[model samples]
Target chain A: MSVAMPPGSAFLPLSVSLRGARLVYDDLLLFDGLDLELVGGSLTCLLGPSGIGKSSLLRLLAGLAPRGMSGHLHDGSGQSLRHQVAYMAQQDLLLPWLSVLDNVLLGSRLRGEPPDRSRALDLLARVGLTEVAHSRPAALSGGMRQRAALARTLMEQRPLVLMDEPFSGLDALTRLRLQDLAAELLAGCTVLLVTHDPLEALRLGEHILVMNGRPATLSALPELPGAPPRDPGDPALQAAYRAILRQLDAGSR
Target chain B: MKARLWRALLTLAGLLLVWQGVVMLGDLPPYIMPDPLAVGVRLWRDAGLLLGHAAVTALEIVLGMLLGTVLGVLSALALGYSRRARRWLLPVLIASQAVPVFALAPLLVLWLGYGMGSKIAMAMLVIYFPVTANFYDGLRHTPGGWLDLARVMAPEGRRWAVLWHIAIPAALPAFGSGLRVAAAVAPIGAVLGEWVGASAGLGYLMLQANSRMQIDLLFAALLVLAVLAVGLYFLVDAGLRRLLPWHPANPATLENG
Candidate 1:
């Protein structure tokens, strides 16, 4: 089931622009002078080999300062994008002590705001986790925990969402199902998803960027035909999967 | 559960047998070593007296734990929430542990007087370190991912909310460990204070019985103190397990039977 958009304010779909971004750690440059733009209301998949700075780029955009990283991240209106962005990492990062429903409302509670319990339940129901809403995170399966995390990310009602391998730990079938769910739920928001799986990029990315080299640069791949939650078996998707593999392999040297 | 109870009973019986064997084989007099049965009889005969002293010691232990835990938790929060507080208080927290608390028993008794006040103070001093150290470590090491999520979710000015909602709850299992250690060792401080100078408590009774050569009564008091320590530890352990239902106990360590 598709998630209902949160009430009161519709998302403004903020477009993010990163210009002349430089990241250095321990005198080793990870990326320098990187320019990237995330078009509003589209899903962008970032694929790169291990330690290639894709997550660092995503973190930079999310306004999380990686030490020694210099960057300018702003929406087009000269305002900061930090308040409009929500982040989801590989680990679900759910508080084991909190009930699943409580975990969904963690953002509100942390912000010292009165939680919208009804909207939280609506998000949970859309994720098909209504039954386990009252259970602790430890009691849920891996897939279920990630679903709850997805619900939590949506609960922020942000215009831009950044996810770093959010489904990498799950089994194959669960990952596919979550990709479809996330696509439906995050239909109109700007999403930058960092993933290792090529097929996942094919299935969900409207625009795919492959990051390569020592001081990494993002090279945009040819846009996939049609919208996301695309059929994995489609000939176009299979062709794109091979192209991504080749691009990643060429960069590994 | 039944199997575990039976195993514990058997272990106690085995230890009693060893005690009885040692007494009989040494042909020791009551002054030197009383049999377990003799101590048991003394325990029955002096039940009221023993209970009175036991009640005093128990009060000191419980109150000390309450005060120590509260102080430790507050200190941990202060250290975690403010960088300035951490810089100033951390050295003092470390130095508090550097000086052996046992060395201060006489000083505590002198300062607080030869009453329950000194004993409770001693108990609180004994437990304060472990509760503070373990909890502070836990707070310092809250999983980075959770903190990152909190940063994005909450506003920058509301950093304390992250510490309260995320870091504090995450640190509870460690705090529980500290509390368990506190319960086990809290009796030591109370008894040590009583040993140095006190008119009441099991420690005082034991000292009196020792002076009079009432070795069996001394043995009875010792046994009661042992029971008190064990009982208090288990109580804290059980309460902690109940409080942190989410902290999974190791199945291998759990009493499955």
Candidate 2:
């Protein structure tokens, strides 16, 4: 389904820089003076082994990093990045009580702003969730629930989106479809996606970064050719995948 | 549903048979422990008197539940929303539970008089804690993911939005639990107040029947009170189920269906 962009929905994408980021969890350093940067309006996939503070780095960018994690986050606009960011987590996190439509409008409702119902419905329709807009999240399938979550994230109309393994919970087929939908919907917005899957990164990321080791540091791999939602069977993508696997394997040791 | 009802009826029948067996085996006098049959006969004979007293007690319990729930919800919201209120009111709320309602019954009667007012207050006092404590716990324990979502979604200085849209709704099932416990114990406060000082209610009837050695009538009163408490509990449970359609009390049953 072709997703229609909401009227006047163009966003000025924000480039974020995190420097001297230090996180000590239970006295074990996670990120010691780590530095990273995101190019404006590009999807950057961060792959790391479990417990390597991948999610924490995304949280730091979303301004939700745990207390005692010292860092400087510059959005290059001399403004706080909090208002400019939208976050999507592994779980759909749709409030069970709210209908799909209400969940889409949640960002507006939470901000105490008047919700544009027609716009929310339009977003839902784009995500192919028009029929179940009035149904509760409990009534939705995992894929449909994430679609609704994506709609909610889009409703925020933020320039920077940080997603932590947002599609990892879905079945392979559903996850692949959602990656395409997310790529199409999140175009022109700077995104930091943290994932454990190499293929997911190869399929969606414009720039792939691997974070590994004690006091984890980020290393950039060569940028993939062509746009995201690239074919998984493509030889270049397969080659990138093997390289990422080797990098992750080396990081573990 | 039909099967459930049948099982409930069977259980009641079994309990009644046990009561009758005990009385018969003990060769108990009617004054000491009237047979189940005697209690049933007394219930039929004094149906009008029993119903009147029951109405009084039921009224007290219902009114008390309403007042207590309102106060409890307000206090929960206060405690959930304000750090200052949580610091000051939480201690007071906990202390209120520590003071037994039985000890407070006499004071309630003295202050609110030997009428429905005292009984209602006693019932309210009995139930207020469960409702407040349960709801506050619910508010405090809103899922971390949801709160994180709210922190990102809601504008700064609009904490009320998060509490209203997310925390309160998330906490409702817990609040419903508190309400159920409150409903079960509501009768205790009202009955205690009646026993302490009252001219009406089943509790008062129970007291008078005991004094007059009408053990069967006393047993009849007790039966009606049990029916009232159980009936009220089911009523509350049913109402809550309807109100919170999103919160399935038994997800397994719902899934099976």
Candidate 3:
């Protein structure tokens, strides 16, 4: 799926159509009759409280969702999209024994290519970890480790990038920096990020899908303004945040 | 230097005092509990011959340990890195452990004869389980993010890349644990094999000394065996510390270490 980079904000031409999807785990129904659509090449931030199945939705979209879950998805231009989508889990699970560069080059290793060391190095440079390319994950701080994990994710070059709480453990400063970096990089890819922070949703998401309640069906898809790389502190950003918070509050009551 | 010497002397003195008290209190004959001085003198007198046999047993332990490492890693890789192999062989491997080493030792001796070969085989039987378990656990426990990163970075047939880049490296901790256990147990297997049926080793020496009522020589042989086990353990432990320098336990002194 070739995602045409949207001007001003990175947009991927996504027309993801899911109809009557259902997921269950050990007799506990996670969702049923779940229908959702993702706009092409758009930054969609999925937000919900814990146990709302937001992460589960991202897993379904990535086709890595667990067994016994069934769903159908269509790409942009009303075409059936069946391609390898990259998945980033909630934890920065870098192999502790490998250096930052080696970890990033692992994608190439798995596919049987002489790991393109230069490309891995460049991507690590992009994440500001060029000097520590030879450093093992155990030697890195939490933020650095997560950054290394992000670089490893980027090495895949997949069209669809799915992130589940990628910024959950970062401090405010590092989280903001990573959010901007993620937005800049995804300028050419389809990104479906599951997050809990409203401000993050406003700052990075072009479209926001709020999930809530039992079996956690899609609550709503609200539009955000100023187009990402939007200013995190812009008045328009605050306005979007305020709107999402109100909806969440109303839903909880 | 002085403090260490003082500590050493104190420890020696305490050990001797305890030995004398136990011997006296138990009303044991000299054959049952030789004085520490008598054992030391006997060990010094037999040092040359005892050292030669100790070297032979030590060689068997080392060779068997190396063999076990190769076998354990290869089997672990075959079982852990492949689904088909794991499905077919994993059960057999687990079931194989139920065959006790003592039960197998005689069979190995029967097959290999009463030589260094038999001793090495016995040691191999003892060393295999820990190494296999540790390596397998380590290989399987590679972080999910690392695998995902590998998929993204290489997206090509860098499967070996995952092996070198992730699997082996991730498995090092568990591998180290296994090696430590194997090192400690290697000498035991050698001694046991000697005990069963062997000549020119510490186990043989112990039996000969005991039959002759050479209690001092028996204690000396036992002492040498303890030293071999401890020395092998320390060497392996130091190597692990060197490899995993970043591990918290490596940087700081562990109570056991």
Candidate 4:
């Protein structure tokens, strides 16, 4: 059930444009004067090497950007952003003490909704985790935990989701399954994903932004060519991956 | 399982043998180092009176634990969320503990008189520290991701519900440890207060028996105190396991899960 948008509140669409964003830490510039836009209802993946501020950019967008950063996001709709965003951190961040179902229902609990246990159950089933709903994160395999985290992110009914290497530690098959699941659930929302894998960026991202350090900046933003839930072997994905890799390799040199 | 049971039995036998050997070798006198069997016999003979005293002590311990837990949680919540309160109150709490229970016991007895009141007060004091520290630390260390989730999830309304539903459950493990530590230390405080001055209780009984050179009875009382402490600790531990059944320590099987 969609909650009534608060009175005198503005609703920010899924689109986000970062104008002249910069961030610094301890006299070191993580990102400087970066400009980017994530079109509404699309998945944008930030792909780059380690220490390239990909995650830092995601953090900035989440409004949790650490001290010493300035950025303004211009949503297509003139309304200010509401609290319609969910974040999946680098770690699974599942409460180890809670069952998988309970963890998924956590967002509902925090939202003061009568924990939609059925939503949690359905999300678990979508991730092929119905059998493990009552299991703890610690008891489940790594992939299962990630799936649970994904379920939690989706259960929030947010319009925007930020994922930081959400599938980093999973095996290839598990990663593919989760990638599909994410695309399905977030069909109508925007996603900002940060990852190091070109394949992951190509597999899931509609727009790919490659970043680099030493005055971190976006090296490339390749427009992917495919429909929703693109296949791995799509010709456009291969072309985009190759083009993005050249920019990344050229930047490293 | 067999190995653990065997190890436990061996350890018990070893302890029993050491006690017997000590009594035989010391042979100083029955009034001083009574044999384990003599201690057991004395315990059996006075079981009725000892049980009565034990019941009172147990009641004081349970009540004090409940009171101390409530105080600890309230103080932890206040201190954890408020920086100014933490700065002022935390030091006072530490300083309070520095004045050892033994030194304060007599004063407590004089103030409250020789009743259960002084013992419960002592127990509350002893149990308060671990509970406060552990709970406060837990609340302070709740994962940042969860808080962020709460903010995003409840932007429209119901802030308190978010904190209680998200933050409190996240801190349960630390809360469990705090209570367990507090429960373990609680009995010691009660016994110490009883020692200072009491007309009844196992601690008082031990003092009386010791003064009369009934060493076996004193030992019996000491054993009962140890058992009570262990029992209380395990009871809290069991409760923690039951509450957080999905905790890593007790991995739920597929059926239970």
Question: Which candidate number maximizes lDDT?
Answer: 2
Residue range B140-245, candidate 1, lDDT tens digits? 8899999889988874748778878999888988888888899999999899989999999999999999999999999999999999999999888878888887
CA displacement after TM-score superposition, residue A243 of candidate 2 (Å): 1.8
Sort the candidates on lDDT, descending order. Answer: 2, 1, 4, 3
TM-score of chain A of each: 0.96, 0.97, 0.87, 0.87
What Cα-based lDDT does every candidate model obtain? 0.90, 0.90, 0.79, 0.80
Which candidate number has the best DockQ?
A: 1
In model 3, how large is the Cα lDDT of residue A118?
Answer: 81
What would the per-residue lDDT of candidate 3 be over residues A118-182, giving only the tens digit for each residue? 87887787778988999878778888887887787777766667898998888999888888877
Best by TM-score: 1
lDDT of 4 by residue, A67-128 (tens): 88878765667544556578897688887767899989877776666887876787778778
Name model 3 segments beyond 4 Å from true: A1-20, A77-84, A219-222, A229-236, A250-253, B1-17, B20-29, B81-96, B140-165, B246-257
Please tell me how candidate 3 rates in CAPRI terms.
acceptable
Q: List the residue pairs that clash in candidate 1.
A: B1-B257
TM-score of each: 0.97, 0.95, 0.85, 0.90
**Clash pairs for candidate 4:** none
